[model samples]
Target: FHIELPMSLSDLVRLCGFRAAASPIHCRASSPPHSLPPAPVDGLDESLLADDLGAMELELRHRDAYLRSLGSPSAETVARSTLVTDSQVDQIMASEGPLDRLKDLYALNEDNEPSYELASVMLVSMATFTYLNVRYTVQERRLAGVSFEERNKLTVFASKQQASRRKMDYITMRALRLGLKRSASSLIFAPLFLGGAQCISAVRGRSSPLDFLPSGIAAGACVRGAHGLQPMLGGAFLGGFLGAVVGTVVYGIQMYCGLTYEEMRRYRLTERSERDARLMAKLSAAREQA
Candidate 1:
């Protein structure tokens, strides 16, 4: 007798408890042929995923190292790369003395004009000269009529008498006041004289002795203008005569020495450098001893 099964083959396997007996070919055949297979899940191989993660971490570390190498150097690296060492810097600083500092204060560079240096030099010299002149003139006038013996007698009397002390004090104060006034005037006069002389020299395209005459005359006129016409004339005459004498002397010196202003300045700078070098050597020896 022949019989037909009502259930499917999968149901027959389940009923008969024959799961192991179910064939893969039969299972595949049971499904629709048009359907695709399911995709693989990611966590199937943990070691492979871990290996990939470790490779990415190593690459990131390499990239970070490269970026750091391209960045600015560390402080220690900069210090090592510097041209001047700390001890050399300290020595350089220590080499500059008071005189060097003073020279630096009035230092002239190529960009600076000669007129400025001339004016500064003249101002200092004239101030000293004016003070001495005023003091001498005052003392000379005070002692004009008296003989040498009489002056000695007067000095002795002044030392003994209180009234003479007041007179002596008056003379001293008067001389001081006159010296200060003339020195103050010289501060203004010297700059004007030098500036005017410089301007005249520049316009003429060369220096001349005659350049000082006009400058001195103008400076004297300005200074004495507040006094009177007679005083102004007298000052101008005196200034012109002195200016001419000074010019002649200066020209003579230049001719004798064969040195220009620039040459003199260079010589002075060389001398100063030598002096500074000697000073530096002494300081270095002293430091070594210490």
Candidate 2:
């Protein structure tokens, strides 16, 4: 009796010079099976093919997620996950105008520290003072019939006198002292007003249009308390009136805008996300071209 083996197995046995005493082995005489007709590549279902491709993409995403969990993601994974490249960030920062930068600097969030509020207020105060000073200086010079060239000469002379003999013109000295006083007042009042407003808001449990009135009154009373009770009372009344007017105007604007603080914040976030998406698409196209 003979047992037939595949040709390849028989050849392996022959090459190794192995023989089984129980039965003789012979190579099968039949030809090798032909490979199945390559799965009919021409008339395949397009929808089924698309579904398969989609499944493959999902599987790749899962694989990338797994790799990320292990903290050893591939370069391709990192590239796909990144929102923006370093160059893109640089371009965005460069494209920002001064006004945009200034807005960003002054922008405040609920989570921000008191120091941030203080700094923002200080900046506003400084800007106010600068504008007022410039206007005052121009008006005074005009009233004195001082030409631009003459003013420049006086400024130079004042600087020279101060440098050489520690003496400055009386008008220049007075202006300098006034600026210093205003700056000092700003430093003191900014914190007082901000703290009072925050305290009132916290006590109220929510903000209201009238929240500023008491805060302003307290701030004003403190500012004028050094003079007398009458002055303090007058200051408080004035402050409360101003605060109420400001609050009313602000509330009216909010009503007109048809959006609350939360809505505005969400809108800004949505806009930022859309902008980032556009930038990302542009970057991807550029990468594909490269």
Best by lDDT: 1
Off by over 4 Å in 1: 1-116, 119-127, 130-134, 137-165, 261-290
lDDT of 1 by residue, 209-229 (tens): 787788888888888878999
Over 4 Å off in model 2, which ranges?
1-56, 59-119, 132-168, 252-290
**Compared with the true structure, what per-residue lDDT tens digits does model 2 show for residues 70-158?**
55544464456544455555455556554553354336644564334346466766775666666665455344333334455545544
Candidate 1: lDDT of 112? 73
Model 1 residue 274 distance off true place after TM-score fit, in angstroms: 21
TM-score of each: 0.39, 0.42
Clashing pairs in 2: none
Relative to the true structure, candidate 1 has a C-alpha RMSD (angstroms) of 30.2
The deviation in Å at residue 164 for candidate 2 is: 16
Q: What is the lDDT of residue 96 in candidate 1?
A: 52
* Local accuracy by lDDT, each model: 0.60, 0.55
